[model samples]
Target: MPRSFDEILDQAAVPDTVTDADLDALKQEIVRDVTATLMFGARPAPEGRYPTTLDRAEAALTALCAELIHSTDAAEHLARIADLPIDADGALHFGCLLNLAQEPDGALWWWQFAAGAGNATAAYCLYLYHLFHGELRDADHWAHEALSLDTDIHLTSPAPCRRRKLDSPPEVLREAIERLKVDEVAGAQFHHPDHRLADQIEELADAC
Candidate 1:
């Protein structure tokens, strides 16, 4: 039988003994594979077509980087990540920045970059960021953008799991920001609750 998604990810995950060179090589490989998947849609392999397994493997590698990356290497690592194409809206690049980089501001910049490139998850995170900082107007706009991407989104889960709103607003926002809490970006995903707050907030902004 074919290996399961979790199995593949476990097998492909970066080892704790991974060296700088090994990590660099793995990142390059992930960039290539993800780029090809984005470009070609689906490439035929002897085993099968592209699936969630590949995506999970990529995330596992990125999460591992969050664990093994050194503070001194963060700048160089970010520079390499920035070079990856944004066709996937720099998902992998942003993930590494958000989950590994020690500088919160720098990670936020990468989130803005990804959101600008139309990454819904990044946009939602930006929404939460702005909301937490009391920039409700900007948060409203980002929330709208996120919903526009996934109309029936449920903004609760820490990852792309089933639809539910178990997390409270504070918890949701906290989890989003806490993604940078070192070695923990494996399954981070975001969604937005159904609401017309964005339009109302925009109108309020206009009047101000």
Candidate 2:
């Protein structure tokens, strides 16, 4: 039997012992996993067949990256992902890197591109951007857009299961900024009843 989603997530969260070789191996694994899943979905592309399994696999890898990659090699991870093709909504991978890089402008650009292509992660990133920058109207738009596209609500909740440590201060700082935006939007929105209980989220954003 296949491992459950929670099991896969737990496995992905295991911190790799920091080594250049370890980083390289993990990077290769990520790229391979991402590419394999994308190609699997593309197998019936000309006929427009929706490969739900492949899509879920892709999302799982993305969430894994979001949960795992941290300060020690965050820049390297970002650089690697930035080199990948942004053909699909997978550009969220690149935007996540930009967020890690603390390049809000760059992150916003990629996020918008992915959002236009219907990536909920990208939409959520863009929403957070506007929220932190105090662009309320645009923030609301992107927040709603994110919600509209994110039918599964994968990253919306600030669960402890989603928390991970960064190996560097800069990376942690950047992550904090991004988290702040997430909470800001979450707080202002009345649609989510759970938003009120997101105290840590509010605190994290406030610190930024």
Candidate 3:
């Protein structure tokens, strides 16, 4: 049988010879690896780029939680994980908390918190959520914010999840509509009466 999260933590052994700095570094590396592997299927370089197994991914997360629980410098650890000053990786970590919740409301709270802290991935997820819910204006705004950080970026849930239809990078869809001629791109789809130049903001949620 697979070990439970607590069991995995109980099994983790740190040598007396390992310095705190090294332990901290190890914790950071593990968090980064699990996040990239689970979320985007990307591997941190100098390592092979392959998806992490479910058991190993869970173990990494459980170990990181254990590290936080036992960390002597709690403030520094908190600062590192909270995506302070807009670190995209840190934001993604917080977003993982949503998957652990019983309902999306709780997850949205955390995602919003992370997005407010300038986590672009969180904002992008919010954009998708709003789009799925048919809230065009809100979706358009968050999508813009998300694209500002990385045009080529594509986000996916780390695991099988609901409301996961946003597969293309927002910039891709935006560029497609940009190629339309002046006469063809008119009307509510191209121009919102409330905000000019907001082309395809309304139609995209329905079409996609």
Candidate 4:
């Protein structure tokens, strides 16, 4: 008796907390913890080098994959969870792996898959990807999608707008701007064939 992907997704849609705000907060915390652990690795290591954190993160990500695999039957769910195309099914375990991937092509493939599957965090990540890669059209499209999903999750009030206003610190804003430029340049360098919309992405990224 295994659960279906639809079952898990429906369950995931329900707020486990008393309120939508609390549910949103929980999701954010989970993303923050997962991101921090996956990206920076664990802290407090020897001065010269520290690879244990990366190992630990990889292990944790593996566990997440195991959970998803054990819980669902939908092939798309597995594909989305791993961040690969419907057919590609790449071997990515953690969300942060997208950043560390050698080829942006592979990463973008997975992000697109996950975003299509209604993973809000994946949508946000895709937004970031387009933001960086100077794909203004896709960036705005994905950002709006993420915001819409967040709103749907809340069901009572608009949370994305409020969260954006509250989260906009000067440093974060500056970093976002820098990322936009880098993404634009990187997009042009790596994805020049699709660089027609880089200028548009640059403008939106700057405004953000």
- Top candidate by lDDT: 2
Give residue 132's error in model 4 in angstroms: 1.6
Q: Give candidate 4 misplaced runs (Cα > 4 Å).
A: 1-95, 151-208
lDDT of 3: 0.44
Query: lDDT for each of the candidates?
Result: 0.45, 0.48, 0.44, 0.41
Q: Pick the TM-score winner.
A: 2
Q: Which whole-number lDDT from 0 to 100 does residue 32 have in model 1?
A: 50
Give the TM-scores of the predictions, in the order they appear: 0.33, 0.39, 0.32, 0.30
What TM-score should be assigned to candidate 3? Answer: 0.32
lDDT of 2 at 129: 60
Worst-scoring 10-residue span by lDDT in model 2? 189-198
> Could you tell me how far off, in angstroms, the CA of residue 8 lies in candidate 2 after the best superposition?
77
* Model 2 TM-score (2 dp): 0.39
Candidate achieving higher lDDT, 2 or 3: 2
Q: Candidate 1's residue-wise lDDT over 141-165, tens digit each? A: 8778977766653244334332222
**lDDT tens per residue, model 2, 36-143:** 445333222221465333333333433433542332443433344334444324355545544444445555665676788777767766655654443446866887
Question: What would the C-alpha RMSD of candidate 3 be, to one decimal place?
Answer: 21.5
Looking at model 2, residue 5 earns an lDDT score of 100
In model 1, which residue pairs have backbone atoms overlapping below 3 Å? 155-191
